[model samples]
Target: AKLRGENGCPWDRKQTAQTLVKYIRNETEELIAAIENKDKENICEELGDVLYLICMITAINEEQGNFTFPQVVQGINEKLIRRHPHVFAGTRYKDEEELARQWEAIKAEEKREHRQAAEKREP
Candidate 1:
């Protein structure tokens, strides 16, 4: 973020979420292409680019008081644990189809919870 401060690069300081999102999309495509081509070096480079954009976006949101980086990490960690009952809870799945069903159910539950929270915050 220092590179986006007062004495930072003029271009970097001028970037917004909208602009950074374009870079994120492009980097994602490059990563996908690298995977398709089985290019390990390009895959690593693209992944780094994607991570940089994500971090930059998080920093911008942090500046706006929207959320902290730790909140983002915590949310993903909790979501993973909540979704993977087979791995974390010793629950057995009969097959891939059953595992997928369980995953979708967990996702739907998460969506419902998010909607309820949003409704609670609405006037």
Candidate 2:
């Protein structure tokens, strides 16, 4: 609340979800540069910067009462569990080829479900 309050930094308060694109792109480039340099230290530092931007953006959404960080994390964690059949769903895999097949199958199912849900929406 304080961060988004009037007393907060004007730059931060004025930021919208759409405005973060350049920031995300810049952080992504920085991370890529660190990786290309083969500098483990810079890689770690730049990764933190990228993650910080993500968190900040999440906070922006939360201030608007759109979604919270825990909700986003939970959704992704559940999706990971849903997607990895061989790891958690007691599905058998023979090799990397079979693993890839399972992953794609799970992904396609998720996509179909999402599409169906979207189709049902008014918008």
What are the Cα lDDT values of the candidates? 0.92, 0.87
Once model 2 is optimally superposed onto the true structure by TM-score, how far is the C-alpha of residue 67 displaced, in angstroms?
A: 1.1
Once fitted onto the true fold, the runs of candidate 2 whose alpha carbons sit more than 4 angstroms away are: none
lDDT of 1 by residue, 41-95 (tens): 9999999999988898888888889998999999999889989999889999999
Q: How well does candidate 2 match the true structure in TM-score terms?
A: 0.89
Tell how far residue 95 is off in model 1, in angstroms.
Answer: 1.4
* lDDT for position 77 in model 2: 97
Native-referenced Cα lDDT, model 2: 0.87
